[model samples]
Target chain A: MSILVDKDTKLVVAGLTGREGSFHGLNNRRYGTDLVAGVTPSKGGQDVEGVPVFDTVHAAVQEAGANTAMVFVPPPAAADAILEAADAGVELVICITEGIPAHDMLRVYTHLRRDERTRLVGPNCPGILSPGKANVGIIPAHFFSEGNVGLVSRSGTLTYQIGNELAQRGFGNSTIVGIGGDPVVGSSFIDVIAQFESDPETELIVMCGEIGGDEEERTADYIAESVSKPVVAYIAGFTAPPGKTMGHAGAIVSGSKGTAAAKAEALEAKGVRVGRNPTEVADAASEALA
Target chain B: MDLLEYQGKQLFARHGVPIPEGRPAATIEEAVIAADEVGYPVVIKAQVLIGGRGKAGGIKLANDREEAERHAKAIIGMDIHGFTVHQLYVEKASDIAEEYYAAVVFDRGAKQPMVMLSRMGGMEVEEIAEKDPTAIARLHVDPLVGFQAFHGRRLAFESGIAEDVIRPVGTMLERLYEAFVGEDAMLLEVNPLLVTGDREVVALDAKVTLDGNALYRHPETAELRNTGAEDPQERMARERGLTYVKLDGNVGILGNGAGLVMSTLDVVAQAGGRPANFLDAGGGSKAEEISNAVEVILANPKVTGVLFNIFGGITRCDEVANGLITAFGSLDISVPFVVRLDGTNDEEGRRLLADADLPNVHVEKTMLEAASRAVELAGEAPPEDADRPGPSAGADPDADPEQ
Candidate 1:
């Protein structure tokens, strides 16, 4: 059993006619996800690789029975696309678009909180993949194998790197969620860890975090209190100088706070084994499961 | 992007927030002229981005032309916190009757815009919070509902703001909120919000940090990126559209993603070598982007060794190999390079590098081995003629280090 998606999911791709949307939209469909509909304003009658297209999310929901939305709209219009999905009563929205302004995300976040029906994943993230059941967003589904471990991270390629390492060690994942590296994302580490804890298939959890905010330290407290599943954590940016963003907008060290050593120490104090590298992370996961 | 004090005041003035009248001067002559125009008893403040300028003797009060010139001569070109002061902000001094603090910053844990107010100012907010938690009144504003007058009034009353200035302070909060939203600022702080003898509130200092991602919407503010104040290597990376941060070490580091690059730095440090810089070529980086990243990393004169750690996802190792080849073709590389390529198309990438058999370039299988090898190489004696002029060699001719 996966946390966010499964065989019962009916998917709709927002901005489906665009370059990235069409590419990954078809990729997800080829992976056997129930790609039901597409949304491209003023192009309702058109279709993208056998999926029906609608001008609005409401039409896609009413006619095609789309229960979920994967947004690839450009950064400027991406926030409105998510709001439109929520307005149309889509249960879950996953935004793959990067570079949406933080101010816009704040408004979208506040709106989603009030709406309460829709759960948003990312505005700048590689989407979730529950292997053998569903594939979503940009995660290379081939790297993952269906098993008992659950993976969540704030990075894209780094997540894939760890997945490859774990797979090499004979540890497959139940579900992999990329909550994004933006300062204000839809979900946090604790939010996804809680899901993994309740899932029957997920016996172990691996969390990947980087420097920036106190999210990792806070997640350490949450894991100590609530998560009974064995958790292995990896944090990055130990040598990062203060007040410089490495690559991702949120991957930075501000003053003396948000250092990787501090994060690793915090997780270790909570009885979690913090990996020093991706290979170490997989080894730690293997030890926990063993 | 942190705005200098003068730039922050300019932005505040645009948003109708009261700020002391000031003008920025790049030369001592201009500073004295500005002081003359602003009248007597002007403050000559160094226009540097780093904090603690006051403690560094970068700020001085002048009563007349002779004093203004002397202060400007002392402040200009002064090195404060490793940043040379190329400009001075001359402003008329204020007669303060009271001091307060106010700021609007994103509360990351709560995922909301937090408005903070405190009657205790002229000190670090952290000190205030630690000394007395209740000294600062905090309120989170929902972007959907927006900040309103009641939010400010509540904070004022909670922080025990004087009754006579509560209404004015509340109005100031509204304007500050507008500035925060309109300018796309991540942090807009007015420390020591001074209440003058005339019972008027004016911002004595402005500390603003705008969202770098949102700068595309603010072209005018985007142009305020002080090129003269930036590290030459960092400025080059910015121009090349690469996310790079300059560090003080010898092992130049490059990788595909932020997390991976950061991990590389940590691994290098753990292996007993300091990283020269952080350069993330980004996911799915094309051959050209990799070439650019290599150039940027090598441009740092402090780099004695290089490490390329790529964990391919969308970024294929073969493409990275091609980029490395291209860099070798274009650049006369002197330092030793250690490359660790894994994941998608990694074998192919390794084969390409083996076929090239480039001089001084070694390929390792894991991040640990590569970092260890790079550190070992960095500890070696430099090859003859490694010493060369840096990109910023002649950029600042007048920056006297001993000033």
Candidate 2:
């Protein structure tokens, strides 16, 4: 009943020979994700541990039947790697690489929309994890406990913090998706929330958002009309000063718009309980479960 | 990376967009010389990266050398919205037949670049958006197919652009699009895109914001980063590659990730403490980076206390603890610190902190507890050596006879 990953998922590591790529790729494999192949261009014939390596994603698809891609390439080459995976007809592409130019993602986004073959997750995201079933990106597998609540967030360490809180409260997760903190991510809050709504294993959803864009406000509107499940949400950056980016590329308060208070009010109006802080968010989710 | 007006116009000129003759001057003499060279009836504009400059009296029309010098002298050292102007853009003023607006900006909701045109220009776009939304013609340019002339023509026709100048406006729109994409700009706007008395359409003003992330590709444009106008603390943090934003408060805050740091700021505020700055050491930060962050945070004189909210994912809590210990050894830390360590290697990190027994350091188990402690520490009686404003310090302004 998980949304994206499961036991049947065959994953390929796009930059598997690089420093960060090798580390996270091996980590995902250790977590029992079905990592079948690695792509490193020149050093394609080499293998990391026991996984096979191929120069092209096409070869990985042909030889290893890799249906999913997890990219850890450097920012400059990351978009091209995602495009290559999409062109090879991989069903899903998750990019863990951060700092990709917005223009690069803009072009990639346009192509992916028209191609309609690959579902990209992030150009600057923590990736996804269907707890106890499969792990895809950089999300730590140990914090999550298998349960019925689906969690989606725009941040990484913050997601782990909330996930830890839930686990300590004896609430496990069905899936935790980090949609990224970039302005032009592949998946939006609405996209993942829609998936959670249809997921039978997911009964209550937890959303983590921050100041920046109208994505969270729009998601609140969608939840009011569509979602049947209860959603508890938390938005960071309440005290953030306007016109300054708070680490995340998308986490900025522009003028009077996109404040955390505005976002919280928007969700609360839609029958979604908005938490004042992370602890309160977990508490609200716990109460909804009760 | 919001470019100054002169810089924006320079970029527009590079893309074949017609603009008024202008020169950027850093002094009154330079401005007068530029005004003389550009001919009489010039406009002297304060070169600051803020809005409402026109309303703030930062812009003035000069008919001759005397007027230009006076305007530049009044503007070059003037402050507008906390930003002190150090430069001026002197240019030949235009004779306007009609004013129109054209811009290319990123549409975050639509996930595409949007090109907009409004017949109503010379006024703020926000005002136009509120008064008459339908007066503007907007189109989302698909990056794959790219922006076409047809799109521009359609915008002109829909916005009721003057039929006589529609072709030129369309061409200008296409050129603006080219500049927007070519320069990796987040926004490229031409406010008061003028239709002159001679029927020539030219850009009277330029507002361009280049994407900071894309600067690596354009080194020349990256040089336009003006550090002089930035907050000193923010400039210091930027040099170290740390994500830091200065705020007008007392409690200095540091954390692991953007979200966590932002959350910490809110929690601290809720606990009745205002944050002095926002600093994220970033993921997987090592001991040295943490020590560097501590140095930067403590450097702010307004900070009475600090909070370290570390929720380790890839970042190890012990490394952060080691960083704090290292900072204590190297720096003179006067402010009290509240540390909250959780996740990977939390027990070891806590043990190390306890073993260090730093007098100013306090460890808490939860975020709320840490925030409360930090706020309480900040509200306590100030030390004798604290850099608090006193009668003696405040008397310096009184000593000035100019008042």
Best by DockQ: 2
Residue-by-residue lDDT tens digits, candidate 1, A22-106: 9898999999999999999999999987789999999999999999999999888889999999999999999988788889888
Model 1 — TM-score against the truth?
0.94
User: TM-scores of all models?
Assistant: 0.94, 0.95
Q: Rate the local accuracy (lDDT) of all candidates.
A: 0.88, 0.89
Report DockQ per prediction, comma-separated.
0.52, 0.54
lDDT per residue, candidate 1, B106-211, as tens digits? 7665778889898988877776676776778888898878899899999999988788999888988899999999998988999988889988999999999998
**Model 1: how far is A103 from its true place, Å?**
1.5
| Model 2: lDDT of residue B332 | 89
**What residue pairs are clashing in model 2?**
none
